[model samples]
Target: MPDPIYVPVLKARQAELAALSEIQPATRKAILPVLEIAPSEVDDPQVVSDAVDRISKKLEVWGGNELIVDAGFLSAGIRLPSGQGATMYATAKARSLGIGAIPVARLSDGDSARADVRNLQVEYDCGVAVRLSMEDMDEDPEELDSSITALLGDVSVRRDQADLILDLASVQGDIAVRGGSRIVLDVLRELEKVEQWRRVIVTSGAFPVDLSSVVPWVQSEFQRYDAALWDAIRGRRRLPRIPIYGDYSVAFPLLVSGPPFAPAPQLRYTLGDRWLFLKGRKNDPRGSEQFYEVCEQVAMHSEFAGAALGTADARIASPREHGPGNGSTWRKIGTVHHLDFVVGRITTLGEP
Candidate 1:
């Protein structure tokens, strides 16, 4: 039996599926922070409470939008050291806050993936929602397609009553590259052939790349790739019906319904400061200077005119040496700094 609370949500989704064709393209900006909580803190009630509060505050800033709690980062098997999963705790907390939660499933093998789905069905029984992140998709395209088909078939047969959200981050590829766009389009084309799973939510658009490695001349080309891919999707007449979500990294909405826009000013300012700080720490200032020059090129690009330098901040903590060296082990103490950004938000036409 399904949880009584989840039955209504499922019913609402079913109704929406029927009316997908008539839906309108509505755009809204939102921030989705994917929280990474350590396992040591998971067992502590107070620690978990504090972490949940912090996440809740972020959601509140976004006007209480649905929270996407990723379970993949927890551990390989989706279980903590205690056997109980962090995903369960996060989902429960989100529900208690009267906000919907989407848990991402990240299993290693096909058998484990199917088993995880069944377990979620039996455990939650109500409000069961799970997302299959594209990053977990098998490298072989045929195998991936078959796996997805089989997973959906199992869901339909078991009546698991789980809402499946497909995170397309991995599929969309890096915006700076051309092949990624083509791959995403191919995947979408293949999925379109499967009629039963047409209603699943699709997260479209690519995550932003680190500006440190990008060429100044190719900045405009990156924006062009993103624009062309989106235009192709729209030309296929699959906007409101298919439902696509945009990434906060690019600051572009789900669909290209209007002219291009820039990321928030604050995002730009913070990223610039982060880049300068990283450059200051580097032994070769020339590399950092070139990186900034490319950023300027991106800002001046016609497609991204008025856009801010949307670079990401990254850091690595470890000693320079490990293992035995000479008579005794020698270690150089320091941290390495790199730049990387995470995509924010999974904007959907309706609540996931």
Candidate 2:
């Protein structure tokens, strides 16, 4: 069948909004450390002003310390900031705060530890918490994505789980296979222990995927990604950032009378930093009130850099009166996560 007819007005509006240049909320100015006037300096207005000027310059010299990196165990007593939305807000803001600290606590090693970190961030509505230091994306693109992809493999599959001894690994167009006689053996092993696997039900924006190479059994997965990517790319100027190493799960919360659809919560998992962005629906006239509360809570807590709790603009299309689910209609909600908001080149692979 021929492709469906395309419209441009709404798509154009969406593209405009998506590409509309706006200052990121968490910027250098927001993170400048406030200088307290010392008694000596305060006695002289000029001294106080000089101190303030010095502090400002120092902060600038820090080059936007929005993300901080540190190692070694920190006290569990390090409590999150109080207030409802503080954690969420702080985490989102933390990124721009440049506070990308990586604590080297013994408890943060290996898969179990990593899983705990991911889960903690998700539960707390922390936007994009990462156990690892931010990786350099400017390096070779192929090498960077490949390293991340491998790291993700280790994170997802535990040693206690089925042993997947991939004798050969390759990214051919769209087909991914760990060849060798153990390939089938690994699948069987994993199936036997499937109960231990975490079942992630993805309910967020779609991403792009090449369809030609996906195995028939997993074609549905590819289709879902296709829909999401296609929806996002409409009237698109630049490519929408796709999931390179993360798992996203969404939950729909019931709403009172604002809209017919429920507000959905989205959880995004990434390698460098992990955070969960949640967007829920509210009935108040100025619906942003509750979200702001949550954002404030995240901000005060050191555990999260900050969070982005706001109305989500992405949507999944619904079925028409006599048509299949369009997969484009979006319900309003808030989202938070720690994955880098960057796009990469589309990859294609062919099956051998």
Global lDDT of each candidate:
0.34, 0.24
Q: What does candidate 2 score in Cα RMSD to the true structure?
A: 21.9
The candidate that wins on TM-score is 1
Clashes in candidate 1: how many?
A: 0
Deviating ranges (above 4 Å) for candidate 2? 1-246, 249-281, 306-336, 341-352
- Per residue, candidate 1 scores C-alpha lDDT tens digits across 150-175 of 66555332213444444444223334
Per-model root-mean-square deviation over C-alphas: 14.7, 21.9
State TM-scores per candidate.
0.45, 0.20
Clashes of 2: 62
For residues 1-352, write the lDDT of model 2, one tens digit per residue: 1110110010111111132112133322222111112222123334433433333333333333322111112222222233212122223333333443111112224444344334424553222212221122223445533543454343443323211111121122212211211222232232233233222111122222222232221112212231232232232333222112111211111111232233322212211122233333335453433344333333333433222311121111111222111112121121112111211111111000
- In order of listing, the candidates' clash counts read 0, 62
